[model samples]
Target: MAEERLIIPKKISNRFLMMIGLGLVLLVAGIVLMMIAGPAHHDAHGAAAATGHHATTWYERFLANLWLNNVYFTGIAIVGVFFTAVQYVAYAGWSVLIKRVLEGLGYYLPVGGVIMLLVFLLPIIFTGHNPLFHWTDHSLYEIDGPNYDPIIAGKSGFLNIPFYTIRLVLYFASWIFFAWWLRKQSVAEDLNGGLTFYDKSIRISAMFLVVFGVTSSLSAWDWVLSIDTHWFSTMFGWYVFASWFITGLAATTLTVIILKQNGYLKMVNANHLHDLGKFTFAFSIFWTYIWFSQFMLIWYANMPEEVTYFRERMGGYEDHYTWILFTNLFVNFVFPFLVLMTRDAKRQMIMLKLVCVVVLFGHWLDFYLMIMPGTLRGDSGFGLIELGTALTFLGIFLNRFTKGLTEASLVPVNHPFLEESIHHHV
Candidate 1:
């Protein structure tokens, strides 16, 4: 069968415009809501008496939102390339029909990477008042100073600005290189018509997997785990990856559904949808397993340091994160598990779409829980700031994503397994 190239309709274009416009309005409003309280935080004594104690500044809260969001969306973008690379390495045939969609999701990587670097820098540049990462302060390492922290001093060799900056650059550099290289090979294969590009992609993908094995984990450690400064987890790397991977799977599935509904991706069928649903279903369970293992181990160990992490999240004087922590498990695990359990449900696009949307928001909340608790002690970070910021990010991501789809056929026509994908069945 001949592949159909995407010619984005006027309505879809208009829809994205409206989405972007609405996002911008909300983003402006969220920015005001977040920053409106900025002036009150500055005081000679350095404590806001109004909130009594532990009253974090609005900039701190804003930076927290920015940091978590940068990490969250960066994971989403990298996992796109990661998913495609995995498909290639496994010699997977059933996913060929949806491969371009994955590629489009991935093309958002360079943008996300730049945004991450900028967000990381913003905390340091803003009068050296880093609410998102308290460890970044140089005073904490001064042994003679009143602000001295033995723990932070000990970890300073790794957590220092120069080393952390290098890793940030390298992670994005490597990830971007792989994303670009594979995309180039894919386009070459489409033009030249051979297995040469395909085999080359496998080799490159294998190398990428090895690189990712190290970087993804370390990046997670740097970006999210280090926020708490004192807590550590063996399960954190995979835990973050699971949320990212499954969220990418759901987003990819959702994009395919939208394209099909708009009268594109002609070779894709219900069987393809079912396969996508199955991947989403399986990964939701996988994510749950990782989450539960991490939680249960920490709960059982009862170690002061280990338990402190969950203690803050599970209970506080404010009890801020307790509900959202449980809600994260339910949304990411239970909802998908129960909804996508049956064969019929997997085959149904409506069910798949529903699961995908919820899973996306669920993982957003998951990241919110991870980062917000560390930055702001008394309040839940589940309001306009998060929602508007995410929508703004979505609009930017969609613009890049749609542009990528228009650059190539929605179906990769020259793929060796294109026929297998067209006829894919459960």
Candidate 2:
């Protein structure tokens, strides 16, 4: 049998282009808004400085911090796509139907890298306040003052500007290389039908997984945990991994459903959906286990530093914290566990779609809980900025994912396990 010819529809490409264009515009607008606001804030503070009454606007602080957090959180999502692709490659499954979706996500790795690099370089570009990370305050390292955090001072040797920049470069390189390699193998398999590409990918994936494990842990610590330098959790790395692992799975499942619904992926049947649903179900449990383990350990130990992290989250932001716990457990754990426990539910499109949506939102809330506490505490309002940033990323992600799907064959025609996948059962 001849191989299926891949063709991306013009409409899909155009839509993707529109989404990218819109996202770019929003990003530019956000930057401009901040730039203008920065000077006005400085002017206001300057006037107050003369009278020895420093006036700082809450709105200005909120916007600045919100932008910083958005950049970091989005980086997590971008890294997530690469993690998902690595898993698929390692498993060597007949996931050709979703390969393009993963590839589309891979495209963001470079863009994400650039965003992170820029965020890290902000202190250098502009002598602005370090709302997101306080370590950027060089004066703290120079003087042993009351305002200086001892913990940050202790880690200064490793966390200094030069080392931080070097680590960031290494992380981006590894991700870009892993994404490129995996995609290259998949594309190569299309031209050369055999297990050679498969074997190579498996080896590469194994190596990449080890690298991913270490890099992901350090990345989480550097980007999120370091914001609150006084606190540390051994479970933090595993916690981050669980969250993003499920996030990647949820994203993959959602992308597949969208394609199937739109008549783009006819070859992907109920069987594939069942497999994806099982993964979604399994990971939901995995994420819950990690969440519980982290929380229980810290709660039980009652160590001041360790416990303070949760205290800030639970006490300071009681409402958001409680809602987050409920959503994480009910939507991510309870609903999926019960629904996907059955053989029939896994194959049911409507049920699976519903669960998938919940899982996606659940993970989004997971990221929110993880990030917001450390960054924005007092008034973490769900305002236009949060909504706009999320919508912008979603629009861009969907556009790229769908267009990438159309570029590759919906089914891996020459894959060794293609038949097994097509006829797979619970």
Candidate 3:
């Protein structure tokens, strides 16, 4: 079979842009409402001001959910580069057919990194509102102050504003640098068609994996886990990593399937879908393993500090977030485990797509559970902030990923394994 260039239809392109427009409208609207909802003000007693009005409650929830979606989407993009790097390092041939899709998805990291820096970090540090990071309230570090938090202060050396800001910058800079370099070399290979860039990619990928292994975990610690400063979990890093990686896999798989359905990537077929399905399935279980391990150990230990995390999540909310819990576990774990367990299921385009969608939303809820408990406590409920923020990032991702596809040949023109990928079959 001969390989041909993939062309995205104008209809699809228009649709993507329209979605982006809608997402922007929603994001702006959500932001306005959040502003109206008001900044979180803690009373002298260290308790959040009793904003008796529902709108004020909406503001806090919106901020938390917005931050959650931003971090979640960023995680997906970061793992996009990680996935591609791993495939390069492993010399994997089967994925060469869909490498462009993965690369396009990876392009959104810089966008997300900027959002985190400008929206989340700058505000926490300069504004000193400290709504997001309680540690940002200098009063907490005061030895005898009403807002004193000895635990957070104990970890102050590492969690201070200056060090935290520097690490955030370094992490994004490193990730963006590696992702840019990898794609640059790959695109150069498409034109030069030699082992020069290919060999370079392998070496960079090897180095990237090592750096990524550490940075990815630390980013999770800083970005997500730190929300509940008192709660600590040794497994938290790996658990979140599994969630982000699997979600990235599902996003990649879905994009590939969508392209194939639209009559592009003619060389890709059931074998490719099956491999993607396997990843989705395998990692869904891996996510479950980490989830259960984290929960079970905390439950077994029954220590006040450790159990506080689950206690807040289970008991903090007015409605008890029990359903979200079930949804996260069932959709992310059980559905994928059962639906994609069969070989035929993995090959079926419809099933694979369905499972991918499930995994994506399930992990979104997972991040929600992780965040809301600490920030909004029992007040967190899914509303415009959740819906609009999700749409906003979803639009940003589609627009960016699609734009990336247009900039390059949808196929890696000079990949040594291109032939093997073309002939790949189960």
Off by more than 4 A, model 1:
34-53
Estimate the TM-score of every prediction. Answer: 0.94, 0.83, 0.92
Best-fitting candidate, scored by lDDT: 1
Tell me the tens digit of each residue's lDDT in model 2 across 162-183.
7888998898788788878877
Worst ten in a row by lDDT for model 1: 42-51
Candidate 2 wrongly placed segments (more than 4 Å): 1-97, 317-320
Model 3, 208-281: lDDT tens digits are: 99999899899989988888898899998898899999999999999889888888887888998999999999
- 1 versus 3: better lDDT goes to: 1
What are the lDDT scores of the predictions, listed in order?
0.83, 0.67, 0.82
| Worst-scoring 10-residue span by lDDT in model 2 | 44-53
Any idea what lDDT model 3 has? 0.82
**On a 0 to 100 scale, what is the lDDT of residue 355 in model 1?**
97
Better of 2 and 3 by lDDT: 3
